[model samples]
Target: MIPLAMLAQFRALHHHLLRLIDGLDDAEYRRQYHPDLSPAGWHLGHCLWVENHWLRAVVLGDDRTTRHDARYYQPQYSPKPERGARLPPRDAQLATVAAGFEANILLLADQDQRLDPTHPLMTDHYLPLFLLQHHSQHLETLRMVMTQRALSRHRHAFHPQARLRATPVAHETVSLEAGDYPIGGAAPKAFDNELAAGNARLEDDTIALRPVSNAEYLGFIESGGYDNPALWDALGRAWLDDHPVEAPDHWRRDGRGWWYGIGLEGPHELEPRAAVHGINLHEARAFARWAGAHLPHEFSWETLARQGRLSLAGQAWEWCDNAFFPYAGFKPFPYLEYSTPWFDGTHYTLRGASRYTPAHTRRPSFRNFHTADKRHIFAGLRLAF
Candidate 1:
């Protein structure tokens, strides 16, 4: 039988998703704020679709028609730019989502059908946990979408007292006597990419105790880091040429000094002590180079994290130098598309959890990957010497 704790967690996540889009109007819910992100309504519908696709169809062998429309919900069937327009009316979409959630909960409670000991996904209640984590991931994306929407619409609802004061940037570093360290482990909750436990060899290296702060990154910006071609690689230079970004995303300036945009709350002063976010791999690498340092290898970062030497819990996602690849004995799980499709060399790996990242997804071995030029993912950098 599915554990009550798992079911409770699922319900809580569902409620959290609803609350994220609680005050949004129909237009806001259906509008796609970022080019890469789908509409809020679409995300809701897509989650429901995934539930039906995995649990009902794949697990239970129930071939009934899905409650959500496949054309708009299935990512392959609909492109990101077109998903906003294809979404159903807001009320209709929410109604369908609500019904689907209820049905899903009931289905999970149906031990006779869904809790078969012989089923792979059912053993140890993996399917429910997977679905919960999947929902949690989308919740983070919705927060990003909300931030983009607030910036696009110039909705500044920030209070004066809410501005964060600058804090001193620590220069503390930790030295690791590296050797062959355990890399990924065999955990039921771990995604397929973080599976097939293995060991990675590393030379002795020194790593930052914490992620680079906003103040340090600001110093890079002031020192003409963006203008210097020496700080960037070929791919980085090409991205810079096209984007022409002088600073991180969500940053705006007026008569007052530099201020960064927070999701829905609008603009606030940059917190110097906080880990610098809104930077892509290229920008992170440039900052590291400007400091005469380099981004840490994923192996080093993971080892440090495992030893509890890294202060990365609930901090910004730190980019690693290594490109995202499957572990040595990697194999795809329930579906091939999740991790297999993104293993191309273009995607770089990020470690740690962002402030917006959910608690359940913040484990050390959990890997977050993105392309070099994509900066919107609350990502930052740490240097290794």
Candidate 2:
């Protein structure tokens, strides 16, 4: 039987995720914030599907849901733009969510002795913890989607006055005497992507003490950094030509000046000291180029992460130059779909935890990745020279 403590934690995570959607109406709930991101309703249903897949089906050998709604929720079937059309009615989706949780609770109560010891959840009795982390990740995505929609449609949703934010300190480039450093760590709860610990021989390079702030990024924007083709790589320039983006995705403008967009918290006048996020890798690379700096490699950033040089506790993730490639000796975990599909050299690696990152999964070895052009996630930039 799952311990009461573990069951309580799972229930708490599920409740917290549902709470994110508590106040929204039907229209708001179904809105797709971006072309790439799933709707809130889909997120809710997907979480239930995932929990049922792992905790109930895989762990307890219950496969009842496979025939009815599982295919609808599969990643292949529920691509972002199509999710809203593909999903069930809002009431039905919510009911599925409730039923999924109830099934999970029953599964936890089964106390099945035939469970596989090698199962991911059973490996260290961290099944519930893993589910909690998964829920946390999706919840953050939902928040981002909601905040972006709020900024675009309802500016009034945000508080008028500025909320307190992280100010950028006087950042200096500090040099690391690099050598063969062991990369990744043995965090018991670490994801499959962080496994197969490897070593890298890094060159001695100077790295930023913190991420680039709005003030620093403003200089680039005001100087026509977006228009200059020389500052960007060919692919980036091509992307710019097609998209013609003027600023970071999170930055909004008024008759006065550009302001930063904080989802749910409302838009605040740009704070010079606050770290600039919601920027894509191309923008980050362009900024680095304009400043005669370079984005840090994943290994170099991990050095800082290892040393605890920066305040990573609640900071947004920093973009790295490394693409999401597997380590030298790599093997897929129980779920091959998690990390295998993304290693196509299109998505770049993002290092460090975000404000929404769960404390339990936060580690120097943790690696997050996304397509280089995507900027909706909690992502920012840091420099290395």
Candidate 3:
């Protein structure tokens, strides 16, 4: 039987997701703010689809299909760019989602089917946990979408006198002794890519105690870090050739200095102590090179995190140097598409949690991946020597 705690958590997560898009109108809800992100409405429907597909359909052995339009809701069927246009009117979509949410609650409360010992997903209530984490992840993405919307709508009301200089913050290092350290996660809630906990050897290296702040990154920018080809890798250089970015995403300049735009309340003066975010792998690598350091390997990062040395947790997602590859005994769980397809060497692993990342997904072994050139994610870097 599903635990009462799991059921309560499910309701809380569902409500949180709904609250994210509460003030958005039909246009805002259906509008695709970024090329990489699905519309807010699409996220709502897709979350329902995933919950239904796994719980009511898979666990309960119900053959009945979801009433919502599959083409718009199923990611495999509708591409990211096309999802916005395909979304139903705002009220219609919410009505469908509300019905689905009720059904999901009932499915979670049902003790008879959950008691089936033969189902691996139902074992230890993994399915409910997975669904909750999955829902939490999409809530993060919805936040990204909303951030993009706010940025797109912002009109720069520049005030030259108001331009504030970023305060200089020093980077401090913590040295770890060379040894084999336990990495990956064996917990039931761990992602498939983080499964079958293993050990990895680490060379004696000094890693930054905290993520690089905006002030340090600003020095890199002013030094023409982007113009220096030697600082970037081959793919990074190529990406730069196509899309030359002068600064981090959401940063704009007036006649006097730089300002950072956050979700509706920004274009505020940049905070020096704050971790630099909205940077992709390329930018992170470039900054590391400029600082005469390197991005930490995923193993090294996990080692530091497990030892409780990573000081700035939940500030920004830290980019790791290594490609996102599977652990030695890796096997896909629940679905093949989740982690299997992303194993291509192009994707890099990001460690730690962003401010928007949910508590359930904040474990050290939880792996987040993205391609080199994508900067829409709230990511930053730390230097390793």
Candidate 4:
């Protein structure tokens, strides 16, 4: 059980989500994206179900509230039906979700912080925060899905969906004995996911740690950086070809003008020093290669994470070259079905949570991923040498 205050916050959160989905109608809910992501309708329902399942069935007594579809909710299988087969209509979906919400919140009321303790849902201290982050992530996904559904005219409406998305991640910087120092967070550990190797020197030395800023990447753009194939990997080059990406997805410069983007700040002139967000690992890798730099290993991020430096964790995801895989000694704990199927080396790892990531989901130990080819969500990169 989470604190009562947080439970209230969660309740309010659900309301906000409902508001975010305000105008979409029944026909719009069942629409699907390629086979990987869920349809907006089922996605929203399942999002509600996940929390309900944990609190109602798994956490509190097996308070089986609404029937949860094991086939659809199982996180193990990829390429599953978009949130499962079509539904009984949008009204039914909303009512079912509403019923689940009422029961789930009661279970969380005045609850123990360590509600279930051993449950993967309970052990994570940051679960609530991750849940908040995750909700925003899906909200963005839904927004994009709707926009791509030929509703480009409605794009203006989606910008505000991510407004309250800043989450706090702890960071710090510490030096290591240089020379190929061991990198990466606890193997399969999640990004919250760098460092330079100078060769063994004094331990506990200090170093500078910062999220990659927009100005740094803007310089890459101003210099015709993407034109050089040397800066791109084969896949990155292919992606560039297929997409014809001039710069960041929402970026534009008019008449030697200052940079601008569609972000929480609305359409403000781009700040170069702000972390260069919304780029996927592939783009980050290409950018680093072009600049003769390297993406820091988990070691650097963990060091920086320890330093409590930049406000990462909840603001946006930090790209790392690592792929999401279990540790050598990984044992299936609370959610075997969730992480195992993704282990076939199909996705790239990212450290830290973006404002859109669920608060329950963001943790230094939490590793999130997508294919290197993806750049749709709010992801950014931190450079290292």
Best by lDDT: 3
Per-residue lDDT tens digits of candidate 3, residues 1-385? 7778888888888888887777799989989999999999989989998887777667666637654465666777788887778788898888888888877787678845543655888777788778889998999999889889878887765453444344443567888899989999865788899987888888998999989888788888878899999999998999999999988887777655546546544456667778889899999999888888899998888889998998887799999999999988999886898999999999999999998898889988889999998888988988887
Question: Residue-wise lDDT of candidate 4 within 1-385, one digit each (tens)?
Answer: 4666777777876775665454667766665643545666766776786776665666665645535465465445424464535454887877777766665666555354436656665555345544555565666566555434442332432322121221222133334444333333331123222111122222333332666567677667666767878888888888888877777755644443444666433344555456767676767887777656667655456555644654444566787766776654455534555556667776877777765555545545456768876665667876665
| Alpha carbon lDDT of each predicted model | 0.82, 0.76, 0.83, 0.58
Q: Which segments of model 1 are wrong by more than 4 Å?
A: 111-114, 155-170
Task: Provide TM-scores for the models.
Answer: 0.94, 0.90, 0.94, 0.71
Model 3: per-residue Cα lDDT at residue 144: 89
Give one digit per residue, the lDDT tens place, for model 1 in 49-111: 889988877777774746447566778788888887777788887777887888888788775
- Name the TM-score of candidate 2: 0.90
- Cα RMSD, each candidate: 2.2, 3.0, 2.0, 7.3
Worst 10 residues of 1 by lDDT: 160-169
**Candidate 1: clashing residue pairs, number:** 0
Candidate 2 residue-wise lDDT, 1-385, digit = tens: 5678877877777786677776666776787888878888888988888887886677768877654768777877656777777666666667668777876766665565556667766776667667777787887788787777766674543332553333323458677785888887664566778878878898898888778887788778878899888999998998888888887786765544435555556666666666778789999999999878888899888877788776532467889998998887777766888889999999899988777766656778888899889888878888876
Backbone clashes counted, model 3: 0
Comparing candidate 2 with candidate 3, which one achieves the higher TM-score? Answer: 3
Query: Of the pair 2 and 4, which is ahead by TM-score?
Result: 2
When 1 and 3 are scored with lDDT, the better candidate is 3
Candidate ranking under lDDT, highest first, comes to 3, 1, 2, 4
